[model samples]
Target: MEATSGMPRPELLQVADAVAREKGIDRDEVLGAMEQAIQKAGRSRYGHEHDIRAHIDRKTGEIKLARFIEVTDDIENDFTQMSLEQARIRDENINLGEFLIDPLPPIDFGRIAAQTAKQVIVQKVRDAERERQFEEYKDRTDEVINGVVKRVEFGNVLVDIGRAEAILRREELIPRETVRQGDRVRALILDVRREQRGPQIFLSRTHPTFMAKLFAQEVPEIYDGIIEIKSVARDPGSRAKISVLSSDSSIDPVGACVGMRGSRVQAVVAELQGEKIDIIQWSEDPATFVVNALAPAEVTKVVLDEETNRIEVVVPDDQLSLAIGRRGQNVRLASQLTGWDIDILTEEDESERRQEEARKRAEMFIKALDVDEVIAHLLVAEGFTSIEEVGYVPLAELAEIEGFEEEIAEELRNRARTFLSEEAERLQKRREELKVADDLVEFNGLSLAVVVRLGENDVKTLEDFADLASDELIEYIGDADNMTMDQANDLIMEARRKLGWFEGLEDETDETSEDAVEGEEA
Candidate 1:
């Protein structure tokens, strides 16, 4: 094993071996990097325009240096390409795509060339190290990793995790938790992304998943799959709630998470800087889950609007403040844990609201049905909430009520229908006054009041309504205004039908029209 100069340069192989061992990279990679460095130096010394290249023989540790020019029919770069006619003068057998190599005398190790070579090797090694780090940590995302704080920069902590350094951004740290150099930190690997500078390994101690993982570590039942963590909501360094379920009926999920004398939860709480933790039993029923999530605060009742995933929780007046917690944190965490939007109300407030609703219904019945207050009260008490229901209910059902005969039931039903028709005519006149488009008025799922409101909001055309998302439509007409997101979605879809955006709609219509024509002919 000797150099191309017939001199012993065994140091090259030894250096490659040492770099490969120390950097945990391939020996061939180091050798190839060295060749590139030598080639760069050769280009600098001979001429920058020459196509200089260097290759090292793997077994012999020998370096070969040469300048190469490609034989081409039409030469574009004179330094690296030659016309066939010009190449034929140099070699009669020259052909296109063949490299014409001229071996050069060995390069002397000049001070400047040595420095340039060192820089190239350093850059290549760094690139290899970055690639290795990315491969190592990319698969470890979502798992907790421990590291020592190497430095702090403008509040962001750079942690040294063995061979790699990961960044814990300022916001990723738990609120008010200060970290200093050399401190041992444990965090979830939230993201591992490759960027222009290098692969960025992002760590977070404040993520909800971090708290979930900590519980998993502390609870054996969770780790063994007997108990499962359903969801976690964290107000880092303040409080948190976790919902857990048990596969076995005998096992209490919440009790298991709490452990004997509250030891398990306290271990997690300590790790999270004494953040108060509430462990609740998970239920498939959304209302029940909401009830369980708002623990330590007595809830009188929970009414869930499944269409909106919103729950109205009525608590005892004394428990209202506690249920809502300081600045609404308890309700907020409960909402997050149950994945439901929550609205808290005191029992007294609930009773008042119920009374007000009943009063409105009674007045509406009295006015629309042309009935006495006693009869309207009877109708309202019987749970007939709207004119449409009274108009549509079976005559037998209405007559069966006390003090109601067939004649009275029939008259009430007729009055309900007449009132609905008059209301429709009024709304239609108002709709026209607002300049609502006829196409939008004909769209299914949008009521007359909704159409009038759309006109007021400048969403008068089918195109305008089609452009709105379900959420946008809900925002326009208020979420609590007798319209669900599903209904809004249906309206938008019907509006799109007018634009022929649905592929099968036209075909179905055509088929139905042809069937109707066939029936008429028969």
Candidate 2:
């Protein structure tokens, strides 16, 4: 706000006091802020302008401005200069360097100076009020706030709480709830942060406790502590799970929540876009808790591991798909709520898991040609596992390694030589087709070490993943867990791109983008 020369100094003081009152600040604070601002702007460049002082006496409704100037024996006797005679009159012990006070009229303020003072006073009062609001709300995290969705801009929801506007990002929005202009949306205040602009309000409706809060608001038993929430997990629009308990055992937490005709829950369900909500009983036993977590799955036996605080639920082979949920979401959320590592096991998965783990152990630290688990299995046929034993055996002793006839080893080497020869030709053609310059593409420049690895068929230039036998490829590579089945597909994309075959290769791109993959896991 700007003040003009037309307005009288008393009129300006009235405006400042009005602003301070509206902002819940003392009138003296606004007057002091305006005086400091004018002094800071008009004073010398060195230290602060301590010579200036201002007062707003509430009883008189008058303002006074004064400047403190030092007195000297040979007084300068200027407009702002004071004499030792004047200084010693105020205090008889006053020395030559002692300061004397002189009052300046408020009417002396210039037009621009008055405007600056008004702006400073308004900003200072507003900032102090915002800080006070931030302190009041800082400890109220996860508590509900009634707000109106003010506007949606750039996919962000601007909510108008009574005191301020809160920003709810799209990630925190519920799938079922679409914020529209002027919609009265209730949200939990996730965080309170003080910023220069004001108190930053972080609001969220998708938080799991939103369900508990809604129930607490609706159900008298829950509000009065008759029913207690045990656990809650939500998938926003589609589903929610809440386990509750009764303290007195006479009143049922679930029944009170569901109401006689499911009236209470229906209010919550409707607010959540009719999301399916499962209200279950909580149990102290880990087994029962785990079973309840994996709802609609009907786990037969829950194997609890105390050391890791994990639960292994073995479901029927047919029910395995149900227990894990679509994309394993059901069990994943259950594990998050229970703070347990959940392993959903089927009879077949149990068997395959053990066998695959054992197979990995048999493949560690073997040389390139001896890396195959199938080859190791065949070697075990004649009692051999370590690479140290394989190197000592006769050239004829390779017959002990699976698929290792001296002749097949020779054929394998020959095949690699031929593959490399064809690779050079294929790379040359690809370079031409892709318009690669001589400076860009190289075929004969590979290191001998890399050539040797390729020579042993340890690493092959992938043509495509769908064509390559992944199970067999896993046998050839030793670091089984580090490499995922998806990597196999990605390798094919890399080879295609290197060969300048860039068209329509979406099924796989490369390992760098695995986390940003477009679809659900295989």
Cα lDDT listed for each candidate? 0.89, 0.67
All candidates: TM-score: 0.89, 0.60
Error of 2 at 416 (Å): 50
Q: Which window of 10 residues has the lowest lDDT sum in candidate 2?
A: 1-10
Q: How many clashing residue pairs are found in candidate 2?
A: 0
Q: What is every candidate's alpha-carbon RMSD to the true fold?
A: 7.9, 14.5
Q: What TM value does model 2 have?
A: 0.60
lDDT of 2 at 310: 68
- Candidate 1: Cα lDDT at 71: 89
Candidate 2 residue runs with Cα over 4 Å from true position: 1-17, 25-28, 37-50, 69-90, 94-100, 347-522
> Which residue pairs collide in model 1, if any?
none
**Model 2: colliding residue pairs:** none
